[model samples]
Target: MATRSAPPSDNLLARIALRFTAFTERWLPDAFGFVLVGTVIVLLLGLATGQSPTALIDGWGKGVWSLVTFTLQMAMIIIGGYALATARPVARVIAWLATIPRTPRAAITFTAAASMITSYLNWAFSLIFAAILAKEIARLVRGVDYRALGAMAFLGLGTVWAQGLSGSAALQVASAESSPKAVQEVIKAGRGTGLIPLTETIFLWQGIVATLIVFVVAVVTAALIAPSGERAKTAADLGIELKPLISPLEAEPKGRPGDWLERSPVFSVLIFAIGAWYLVRHFVNATGSPLNALDLNTINLILLLLALILHWRPHRLVTAVREGAPAAAGVLLQFPLYGGIFGMIAFTGLSATIAGWLVDISNPVLYPALIAIYSCVLGVFVPSGGSKWVIEAPYVLDAANQLQVHQGWMVVVYDLGEASANLLQPFWMLPTLAVLGLKARDIMGYTFAMFLVCFPTVLIVVTLFARTLSFP
Candidate 1:
């Protein structure tokens, strides 16, 4: 155990967090392990509640593939966001940013701020960019702790991404076609189109305030608890081979007819034009605020078109997306398993039983906080935000409806909890870990420290902000 690893930091939080890091380094299982284990636990729980094994098996089999369409949307969240972030211009901007932070503290704070900001735009983009930016910052800034940098780089996903534009739950609920079973119930309950627009979710004034508050808290917390002096571990001290973030397209040979077509701007421009026209027409046709037309499909299409134009060539964009495609591999693999879990709960009486447990414990005033805490705990073990929401939403939102809670607030609440747990769950840390050549244990200490701060901060914000939103 690294509890006695003679770490360099004297900061009380840093010391405390490393104890958790030491523990997790020894015992933490792979994210897939969590899913497999979760499947069993849920099955057992169902059986204990009087659900037959045959029925549970039937539900699992039927539900395993039920979310195929929704799965694709979630996959695109990573691919589209990756392509957009790695575009030459964006990459250039990130490189320029690295040149600005000279001191260790500034470097840490800047990385956190950048990660949170870009994550709020698209989490996949933020993850990649933060990794690249941290690498550059570490090269330039002396005495900066690499682990702290990695943790700061990861703050965006754990803090405010879910409250931002590419947030899965918010986007899912915003589209009637994409809204899951629970949201469909909401729709049936007379939410008009049964769609909660972005305007009422992430873009709401209350949500915006919550996001800003959380962002400031996270950045500040990162700066305060970051290790320094003899306690810090630099990339060099850790013996990591730092590599520059290069465009994946830089390696391809030129000259073949196919290669020429790939490199040519014509196809990219044509596709982008077609996509842009549709987006414009979509807003033009909107019956209410044009922004309400922004949904899961709209966001994905916009990301696709933006990436195409920014890359300026089919080959470059395709290569960029392909490089980032592996990042989505986890989602493709785990989502079906989650769908099965959802099936067991949603298709069975397990949902009401679960809802009853939640309702039994929380009144409307405390319900949001309870849901946020529960979501955070579940997120540590099952980090599939979109699919996890699908599994829990049927019961969670059902509980909210029972208490006459604002359905949209439930989405916001779920998002807050889900993001907070990302602080502890390293599932989404694959890209950052790869980019930094670091293991989950190295940076987890800092993230764990951040979680200690953020988890409570989120609960308070969710509870206090509950009044600012209500069911329409």
Candidate 2:
């Protein structure tokens, strides 16, 4: 029988379909797939290792529930805060930031410094604020490359050091070494407590000094490596300044007479509420049940509700929530997969196997050096310091116990691993890429160079500091 060939239109349609699928695959975050795959791997591992399927399923169910709830809470905060901040006229924010004096260099420096410091606030907040500030600084400079500056700002603000110093995951690990209820104890100890080995611990001064020295080196290196002349043109070309902030009044200047609450009302009431919640939760430890739930999620929910009340627009609130959903979808989806991978590690004894190997090689004297290197390597896969710490902290604590390593030394190693790989992670490049409207490939070209130079410098400093301070 003579074969009937496919129609030209059908072939064209098939090609177009293929092209569309490829495009979606290229850009859209594949976190969902990653999670699903990880879950399967975990399941397979459970079966292979003769672990009870029922237990695995139960554990996974709880982990997934926690992951989803945590992801949603984090997403809401990021989206809500971003929407509120962007709702205001960008020109006003720029004008405000400009009045800070030496608007160009100072803004860049402050933004960089603030990014580093406020990372303790929350990574999402730091990223958003730094991005906004970098955009404003770019506008003031007229011809400076804001995208590059944005990358630098992110590096300084959101880097591993900030993550390490922040009393979050790393602190929990360090405290766990001495106390089982480490997180609560560390919280009780307050920010003034010696959580970071660099800032605390008697023998680990070298590691701390090394971290500082390396940070300085990284900063100087970034400054030296920034593009010069025309190569350093404004981020305007990259579409950063395209979305000019329009005032709500300007959008409807001749509308019905503005209400009393609309005219000179405090828009920052939400910010204040969030602050009050933090203070009550962290310091006062208020007895009220409501105050207890005022974690990252509750705080964000409070802000969103406040924004809605102040704006008095149900439609706008819905729209903001819809818009914000995508902002956190990647994390929401991808973290679960990581959780699944973690499940496999736990079920299959892979993590324990790795830990045993590490313990065997880990000498108390060399633990700091080994930890610094191990952390840097791990940085490739688990880019987020907070997230990485969650997975690795337990192992580190276990290793510390096995080798009789000090909690302070362990903390130093965790920080070293994290900091050395900050410039190298592809995920950390997102804000810069977003600001620049560039692909990862383009930015990686520059960032990889920075990473190559910075990593070795940091490693050496960490090693020297560990040796000098006698951390172990």
Candidate 3:
């Protein structure tokens, strides 16, 4: 060129900055903004409400401790499960699962059943397992779109719906915070000393019926809304010619039967033992001292240490840890920011204010439905089930007390809200997106429609069920 390009003018630079800011607002961690803004309001409230600075500091301290414990537990579940899933251990489990049946219909049914079963073990684990299994099934089916398969896998896993009904971490925490005595009575009634109500015959039956409705609704909606035309045609076009069977490379790794025990039997035993211990400990505590102290956190820490020791050196544990760390890094980084956001909310009394408003709006007859809506909204800010429980549980309990709402029903509402919102929030969908190599915008287009359809159905059914049972 004859002349060099002129430097950008100030107005042009300002315009560029404005556009960049707008772009960030659209794509960046908008979820984080919810928490941040809430925190600021909390701090201002604390200051305006004439609360002592010391009290604010103390509350912040408590919040930090809670965050640390919750994050650690979550990290263990995510990292341990991820490592196991990607390694030889989970391959064996899937191999056994595959042997049961590999048909498209069977894959759907088995995935749905296994999801419910494993969700109690760990929600994160269940989700990861289901995602991996779905991918495998899609590969086997050849012409099937992986995205469609992913959606099916998500629905079948039932992580969101089941978490609301019973035996979910969020529900358990809500139960404890709301009415320790009622939770105890539930345990005594043989509800198994978890978040789920003790009236298994009644509560579980209702839950099962409600779960079925959700299942059918989800499947139908997924089928109808699944992309059509070129995308759908491509998958359909390949359907007939595409092999119904998977190649050895695509299937779970299988080895000599005896050798299978050598590579991962220890981890298998550890997982089983830990689960057994958790259940046994819960049962013992229910019968004996309520102060039962079997620290699952400590157990998880010990298991991780053992994984490092046993799988170190010859097993290349370092590489596994390295690879695994990246997967968890996003969670680890975002969690602290989330904690700060929670801190600000607590400081400003925003959570209490919001919860109070929700309680005020709720009527005895329509309380469950209202609670569900509130939970869904709060879920946008606090996506982690455990963390959401910790921050919102106190306020929810207060609201329940004030509203004379049944704690179990309230827990149900909280579960539905938290779980349903997961499909929309970028944070929860990241893992699914990562697995599929899809963008957030693309994934949201599908999940958003799913959310709109499922959210109302869940609200209506859970509310009606709660009323019929005379749930408090």
Tell me the tens digit of each residue's lDDT in model 2 across 1-472: 3323433433332233223323433554433443464467657756675667776776666554445565565566666755654544433664476456353434445555555554544455555556666665666565554545666556653244433334244444334242245433432343333334323431245554654565566555554444434444366665544444334542423445554334323544555566667656553643322222334554575556555554444444455566555555455556565544444444444445555556678676676667767667555544545555655665676566555555565565666567656555445444434443444443333445556666676556555555444323
Q: Write the residue-wise lDDT of candidate 1 on 261-329 in tens digits.
A: 887899888988898888899989865455446665777788788889998978788887888787777
Give per-candidate clash totals.
3, 5, 7
lDDT top scorer: 1
lDDT string, candidate 3, 44-70, tens digits: 666675656666665655554446766
CA lDDT of each candidate?
0.78, 0.51, 0.53
lDDT: the better of candidates 2 and 3? 3
Model 3, residue 447: distance off in Å is 2.0
Top-scoring candidate (TM-score)? 1
Q: Tell me each candidate's RMSD, in Å, in order.
A: 3.9, 10.5, 10.7
Candidate 1's displacement at residue 386, Å, is 4.4
- Residue pair clashes in candidate 1: 8-230, 8-231, 9-231
Q: Give the least accurate 10-residue stretch of model 2, judged by summed lDDT.
A: 286-295
Assess candidate 1 and give its lDDT. Answer: 0.78
lDDT of 2: 0.51
